[model samples]
Target: MASAITTLAADAPTLSAANTGFMLICSALVMLMTPGLAFFYGGMVRVKSSLNMLMMSFISLGIVTILWVLYGFSLAFGTDSGSLIGWNSDYVGLSGIGITELWDGYTIPVYVFAVFQLMFAVITPALISGALADRVKFGAWVLFTALWVTVVYFPVAHWVWGAGGWLFELGVIDFAGGTAVHINAGAAALGVILVIGKRVGFKKDPMRPHSLPLVMLGAGLLWFGWFGFNAGSWLGNDDGVGAVMFVNTQVATAAAMLAWLGYEKLRHGSFTTLGAASGAVAGLVAITPSGGAVSPLGAIAVGVIAGVLCAMAVGLKYKFGYDDSLDVIGVHLVGGVVGSLLVGLFATGGVQSDVAGLFYGGGLEQLGKQAIGVFAVLAYSLVASALLAFLLDKTIGMRVSEDDEVAGIDQVEHAETAYDFSGAGGGAASRSTAAPAPSAASKKVDA
Candidate 1:
C-alpha cells in the first residue's frame, strides 16, 4: 500500500476526459431515479396519501446526500477495517482528496467516483419508503432514514463493494448492486413493516392505485435512467463491458415485461398495465447485478424467472397478512435473489469475469459464494433495520393515529393534497350551475 501511494505521487495523474464526462452523466441519470421513484410510489398509493408517498422518496435526496458527504462515504468506501467496515481519516467531510487525484486505479477523479456513488447512497433508503407508506409518521420516517442508512446501508455497502470487502473478496459477481442495494433495501423494508404493522385498511380495503398514468410515466423514467445505473458501474467504456451491460439491461427488461404479461393473462385473464410496469421493474432489478456477467440469452432467462417469481411473490403479502403497500419485497428482494444466483448458472466466463457458471462448466463454487453474499446482506439488514424501526416506534412513534391515517396521510403529514376538490362554492354550486347534457345525435358513433 505504501509503495502504491508512493508510485501514485511519483507520476503525474492523467485524467480521461471521456470517462469523466461519461461518469458525470451517469451520476446525473442516477440522481433522477429518486424523483422517478417518488412518482412511481406516489401513483401506486391512494389519492389521500399520494403526496406523502412522494415525499417519502423525495426526502432521501435531501437527507442521504448530506450524510454521504459528512461521514457516510468514509465509512462505506474508505480503507478497510477487520473486513467488516472501513475508515479513512482523510476522507472525513470529503476534505482531504485533491480534485485531480484519480480514484485509485480508475481513470476518473476521486470526486467523480464519490459523487457518482453519492447518488446511489441517496436512492437506497428511498427504496425502503414504499413499504412503510401512508401510515408512518413523517418525523419517525425521517429519523429512520438517517439511522438506517448510517447503521445498515453504509456498512453493507462496505461489505459488498469496498476494497477488501468480504463479499468482494469472496468473488461475488455483483457487477452492480443486487446484494448491496436492492436486497439490502428490500430486506430492510420487510423488517420495518413487520415492526410498524399494516396500513389502516390492509386486506379489507380496495387500496387500488389512484393513477395508472403516473405509474406508467414513472416506470418509463426509471427504464430510461437505468441505462446509467447498470452500465455506469463499469466506470469506463474503454473495454466495451459497459456496452454489453447496457444491451443486456434492455433485453432482460423487455423479456421480463412480456413474461409478466403472459403470466398475468394466464392467471388473471387480463394483461393489466400495472403488471406491465411492475414486470419491467422486476426485470430491471434482476438484471442490475448480473447483466455484466451473462449473455443476452442468459439475460432473457433471468428476466423470465424473475418476472414470474415476482408476480407470484406479490400475492404472498395477502396470504401471510403483511401489508407491503408497494411489493418492494416481491420485486426487489425476489428479483435481486434471482439475478444474483443466476450469475452462477448463466455466466459465460466471457463478459465481466473469466469464471464460468454451472452451465459453462464452472461447478457450484460460484453458486455458494452468491448465496453467502445474498443471505449475509439480507439477514444483517433485516435484523438491523427491524431494531431501528422498533427503537423509533418505542421512543417517538412510527405509525400515525388511526383516525389521521384513514382521513388522509397527505393532509395530516404535509398539510397538502395531490388534488383539490374544494372549488369556490364546493360541489353544491357546481351541481346547480351545470350545463345541459349532450343529445344522443351529438355523440359520435364508433364506426
Candidate 2:
C-alpha cells in the first residue's frame, strides 16, 4: 500500500515520534489477531478436535516470527530483484539495521515496519489451518507453515506491496491485504484441502461446533484488532487517509453483519450466533483492501455484496464435494475477491488518490487491474499450495490415521483435552465425588 510519503521519500525524510509510536501499537494489535483466530477456529470444530484446531493457528505465531526476522522481511520489502522477489544484504537476520533508521521515506523505524508486517505474515498461514482442521498431522502443518511462507507468502507480499514488484508496479490497489493476505490464504486453503482430502466424515456426521461463545469472543477480538490492521497500512496518520480507512472499516463491518444475519434468517429460518460472527468477519475481509479509497456508502454496498455472496459460497463446499471444515474458503477467498474488485467500481477519487472507479466516472481500467491482481494471486497460491501438500502427503504423511482421528486428534496430537471429564466418568474419581443432586425421575420415585 503505497502512500504519499512513500512517493516523496527521496526528500530526506525525518523521524516522526508520533507515527512510530502509533505503528508499534498497531503491530501489537495485529499480533493479538493470531490468538483471536485460534479461538475463532477452535470453537468451530468438534470437541474432539478443539485443542488441535487452536494449536494449528497458534503454531504460526512461533514459526513465522522467527522466519520473519531472518529473511522474510528482506524477501518481502527489501530491494526488488527482477520484480518477482527482493534481496538486500543489510536485512539478513535484521542485523544491519540501526534502531533509529527510518524505513525509506516514512517516519517510522524500519524495525517497527518489519514487526508490523511480521504480524501479517504470522496470521496468513494460520488462516489455512482452519480449512485443514480435524485431520492433518501437527508436524505436517508445522512443516507446511515454514515452507509455504518461504515460498508463497514472502514472494506474494513483495508482489503486492514491495517497491517495483509486479502488482505494486502495475498499480493494483490492495490497500492492506485483500490479495496478499486473505486471497492468498484462502486460495492456498482450497489447494491444500483438495490435496489432503476432506475430514474423516464428509457429509454424514453432525460435526457441529463445540462452542458458539468462543467463536463470538474470537470474532469480537478480531473486530477490535482490525482497526489497526487496516488503518495502519497507510504507515502514518500525517494525512487523513488513515482516518478514512478507519471509518470505512467500521461501516463495512456493520453493514456486512446486518446483511449476513438478514440472509441467514431468510435462507435458514433463523438468525444464528454463528451467522453474526461469520458475517462480521466477511465484512472485515471485504473492507481490508478498499477501505481507504471507497466512501462510507461504497463500503456499505461492498459489505452487503460480500455478506450475501460469502454466505452463499460457504455452501458450495457441500455441493462441490470439498470439505472446507471452517468456511475459510467461503469467507476469505470470496470476500477478498469481492472487496478487491469493488475498488474499481466504488473508488471516489476523493480519497487515497485522484483515481475514480467506474461509478465515479473513471471507467473500467482500475477494474481490469484489480481482476489481474486477484486472479494472479489466486492461481499461484492454489497451484503452489497443492504441490506442497501433495509432496508432504507422499513423504512424511499429512493426515492422521483414521483410528486416531476418530478417537480425537487433540488427545493424540497434543496429549491433552480442552476439558477434564474424568470426575464424571464411572471410575475412582466418580466414586469419590459426592453426587447428591437428584433428577425429576428420582424425585418422583422417592415420592
Candidate 3:
C-alpha cells in the first residue's frame, strides 16, 4: 500500500509548472496594485503635488525590488537565523535556489515565490507613505524607504512568515499578512506621522481628495488584485483554494463597504465616494488575516466590525492631534486589529489545524493566543518603526523644506506634473488659462 501511494505520488502529473505560472501571474497582478495605490493616493492629494504622491508609490517598485533581490529576500524569507531574522544561506543574489526547487512543499518554483513575495515587500512600505503625503521630501522619503525596509519590514516579515519564526512558533494564523503587512505598515505610519508632525494647515484646511474618480479607480484595482493577494496565500492549487477564502473575500468586502457607507450616512448625512473606497479597503484589510481560517459569516462579522471601527478611528487624529494624514491608523491599524482579534471568536471547524476558535467551542485559550499575537506584533512594530524613523531623521533628515512643500513637490522634486495639457490641444490651454491661482489674500483667508 505504501509503495502504491509512493508510485502514485511520483507518477502524478507535475503540476509544479502550472502552480508556478499561476503564482507568477498573481505576482504581476499584485504589482499592478502599486500603481492602483498611486492613483488611490494621487487622487487624495492636492493637484499641486498629485504627481509627487503617485511617484512615491511607483518609486517603491524600483527601490524595493532591487533591495529584495540584493538582500531583502534573504533577511525576510530565508532560513531562520534566530527569532528575529533569516539567514542568507539558501538563496543569495538568486544563487543556489533553482527555478525548479519547490517552496513550502508547493508545486511552484522558488523564483516564483521570491517574485510574488517581492510584490508584498514593495507595497507594504508604500502603503505607509499615505500618512506622510504632501509634506515629506522626495529624496528623504527614498532614503527612508531603504532604511525602513532593512530595519523594520525585513525583520517583521521574518518574524511572522519565515520558517521557525517566533510568531509562527506561537501558532499565530495570518493568512495574508494582517500583522506583517497591514498592522505593521499602519503602526509605522502612525509613528512616522507623530515624528514628522502634521502637514501644513491640516485640520484648518479643507484638504479634500483632488479627484474622486482616481480614488474609485484605485479601489477597483485593489479589489481586483486582492483576489491574488488573498487566494495566492494558499501558494498552490490546493483543496483550500475552492473553499473558505473564495467566498469570504467577496462577502467580507461587500459587508465592510455597506457598513462604512452606513456609518457615513449616519454621521455626515451623505454617502461620499471616498467613504465607499475607504470602506472597501478596510474590509479587505480585515479579511486578510482571517480569510483562510474563518467561515463566510465570520468574514462578514470581521468586515462590518473593521469598517465601523476604522470609520470611528479616522476621527481620532483630530481629537488626539497625531496627524496620520491619510488615516493609516484609522483604517489599517484598527481594521487589522479587529480582524486578528475576531478570528479568535469566529474561526470555526477544521479550516485550520492545532486549534479552534471560541465559536467552535475551543474557548478562550485560542482567543488569548490571538490577542497575544496582535499585541506582540503591534508593540514590536511600533517601537522598531519609531527607532528606524528616528535614525533616518537624525542621519539623513525626513521632511522637506517648508517652502518646497508650499510650492508643491511635483515641480520642486520631480520636475513634472501629473497632467500636462501644454502640448495636448487647444482645450488644454483654455483650461489652464481659465483656472485662477489662489491670490495671496485668498491664501491668507483660507489659511
Candidate 4:
C-alpha cells in the first residue's frame, strides 16, 4: 500500500515546461521587487543618502545572488540536517541536479527552482536595511548581508521549507513565507536598528520623502511582482489556485490601501503619499501569510486590518524611541504577525483540513498554535539576529564614521555618485554639491 501510494504520487503529472516557463517568469518578476524596494526606500530617505539607500538593495542583488549560487542554496534547501540546517550533498555548486530532476512534480528543472528561490533569498535581507538607513557603513552592510544570510536567513529558510524542517513537520502552513521572509527580516531589522542607533537627526528633522513619485513607482512594481510571489508559492501552474491567489493579492492590497489612508486621515488630518505607499505594503504583508488559505472576503479583512494596524504602528517608533526609520517594524514585523495570527481564524476549509480559524469554528486551538508559532519565530529571530549583529559589529565594525556619513555613502563608499549632472571628474565642488543638505525639511517640498 505504501509503495502504491508512492507510485501514485510519483506518477502524478509533473509541471509542464509551459508551467515552469511561467514560474521562471514569475521568479524574474520577483527579482524586480528588490530594485522596486530600492526606489521605495531611496525616495523616503533624505536626499543626501537617497542614492546610498538605493544602492543597499541593489548591492544585495549582486552579493546574495553570488552567495546563493555558491553555498547559500546548499545551506537553505539542499537536504535536511537534524531539522536545523541543510546538507551539502545535493546541488552543491549546482552539481548532480539537472533539468530532468523533478521538483514538486515539475519536469522543468531543479536549477530553475534554485534560481527562483535565490531571488527570494537576495531580497529578504535587503528589506531590513530600510530601518537602519543613512547610518551604517556600506562595507559593514556588505559584511552584514554576507553573514546574516549564512547565519540567520538560510537556517530559518531550512526550518520552514526543507524536507525535514521543524515547522514543516509541525504542520505550520506558511503558504508564502509569513515566518521565513517577513517575520525573519522584520525581527532582524529590529535588531539592526537597536545596534546601529538612530539616524543623525531622526525626529527633529521632519525627514519627509524626497520623491513621492518614486515611492509610488516602487509600490506599483512591488504590487505587480507580488503576484509571482504569492501565486508561485504553489511551485507550479497546476490549477485555479494560482489565479485565486493572484486575485486575492490584488484585492487585499487595494483594501489595505484604502484602510491605511482612512486611518491616516482620521488621525493626522491629512493623507500623505507616504501613508498610501506604506498602506499598500502593509496590505501586501498582511495577505502574504493568509492569501492562499483564506477566501476573497478573508483577504479583504486581513488587508484592511493590516493596513490600519501598521499605519498606526509606524508612530510607535517615535512614541517608543526605537527609530525604525522607514517603519520596517511597523509594516513588515507587525503586519506579518497580524496576518500570520489571523490566518488561524479566517482560513477556510478549501485551504487545508487540519487548519481552520476561530470564525471557522476551529476554536482557540488553532489560534493558540498560531500564537505559539508567532512567539517562537519572533523569539528565535530576535535573539539570533541580535547575536549576528553583535558579532558582525565586533568583528568588522558595523558603522561608518560621522565624517563619511555627512559626506554621503555614494561618493565615500562606492566612489560614484548616482547622478552626474555637472559631468565633472570627481572634483571637490562636485563632491560637495553631490551631497544634499542634511536638513530634510530644506529639500524640495511638494504641494
User: How accurate locally, in lDDT, is each candidate?
Assistant: 0.92, 0.95, 0.85, 0.84
Ranking by lDDT: 2, 1, 3, 4
lDDT of 4 at 440: 52
Across 275-365, the per-residue lDDT of candidate 1 in tens digits comes to 9999999999999999999999999999999999999999999999988899999999999999999999999999998988999999999
* Model 1 score (lDDT): 0.92
Model 3: what TM-score?
0.91
- Candidate 3: where are CA atoms >4 Å away? 1-15, 421-447
Prediction 4 TM-score vs. true: 0.90
Error of 3 at 380 (Å): 1.9
If both were scored by TM-score, which would come out higher, candidate 2 or candidate 3?
Answer: 2
Native RMSD of candidate 2 (Å): 6.2
Candidate 2's clash total is 0
In Å, residue 145's CA in model 4 sits off its true spot by 0.3
Off by over 4 Å in 2: 1-11, 424-447
How much is the lDDT of residue 388 in candidate 3? 74
Give the least accurate 10-residue stretch of model 2, judged by summed lDDT: 1-10
Clashing pairs in 4: 344-357, 345-357, 345-358
Whichever of 2 and 3 has more lDDT, that candidate is 2
| Candidate 4: regions farther than 4 A off | 1-12, 104-108, 352-354, 419-447
Task: Count the clashes in each prediction.
Answer: 0, 0, 0, 3
